[model samples]
Target: MLWPDPAQRDRLVEIRDNLLARIAEAEREGWLGEVEGLQMSLAGAEEKLTQLDRRQSNRSVVDLGIPAPATRVVGAVRNKSVNSSAAHTPVSLP
Candidate 1:
């Protein structure tokens, strides 16, 4: 599975959340066109999320040395470090 880098993942999550909120507001304001646009964006955001998950399987472990260093992802790039929390947070969707 290919996982998105941390920054990309975070951006995707943010986009999804914003889209949801905007969609809700559009519906309330009776703006059908706006609602549709927001819905489409929401769908794209969701698709990208799925793609990210399909690409990355954190469950899969790779060994580089005797002691494996912790890894962090930055925009689909992987960086290894011992103490970094930024690499672990993935977008959790409902």
Candidate 2:
């Protein structure tokens, strides 16, 4: 499962805790089917958390060198001039 939002980690922890409690209750009540399903869900949650840990640990920063300020500013001005001139040009539809 892709946890895009950072808050989802907390939510996942809550879900895991709830599942544990449900599993315990199921076991006490002798609900074999409920116990089996909840156990599977708990396993999946644990696996997702493990995957998240591995992903976090493996993260590394890559440096793509920045362009010079003069080059960027010149290019932006040139593009704006071109765009503005095109917009204001009178079109003669024959």
Candidate 3:
């Protein structure tokens, strides 16, 4: 899942801690390969948690009864002078 719910977040944290412990144990036992793999997995988990946190912080569900304000289009394509000329162009060419 791209963004997991609260329960999934809890599970991910639990799994991450377990993997970290395993990585430490592997390092103590001189199993460098296993430790490397577990470290990569832990990094992935941490990244996912960061992404989820960012998404949650940046999103909001607002309900405004009235419509939103109209947006003004600027730049070459939608400038007032260009828009006036563009409006006269025919859709289909003979």
- Candidates in order, TM-scores: namely 0.55, 0.62, 0.60
Quote the positional error of residue 53 for candidate 1 in Å.
0.7
Q: What is the alpha-carbon lDDT for the whole of candidate 1?
A: 0.83
Segments in model 1 whose C-alpha atoms lie over 4 Å from true places: 1-6, 58-94
Candidate 1 matches the true fold with a TM-score of 0.55
lDDT of 3: 0.84
Residue pairs with colliding backbones in model 3 are none
lDDT tens digits, residues 7-77, model 2?
Answer: 58787788899999999999999999999999999999888777777778888998989966773444333
> Candidates 1 and 3: which is better by TM-score?
3
* Local distance difference test scores for all models: 0.83, 0.83, 0.84
Give one digit per residue, the lDDT tens place, for model 1 in 1-94. 4445655988999989999999999999999999999899999889888887766754577777787677877676567687568668786899
RMSD of each: 25.8, 7.9, 10.9
Model 2, which residues run further than 4 Å from truth? Answer: 1-4, 66-94
Clashes by residue pair, model 2? none
Clashes per candidate, residues 3 or more apart or on different chains: 7, 0, 0
**Which of the two candidates, 2 or 3, achieves a greater lDDT against the reference?**
3
User: Model 3 — which ten-residue stretch has the worst lDDT?
Assistant: 74-83
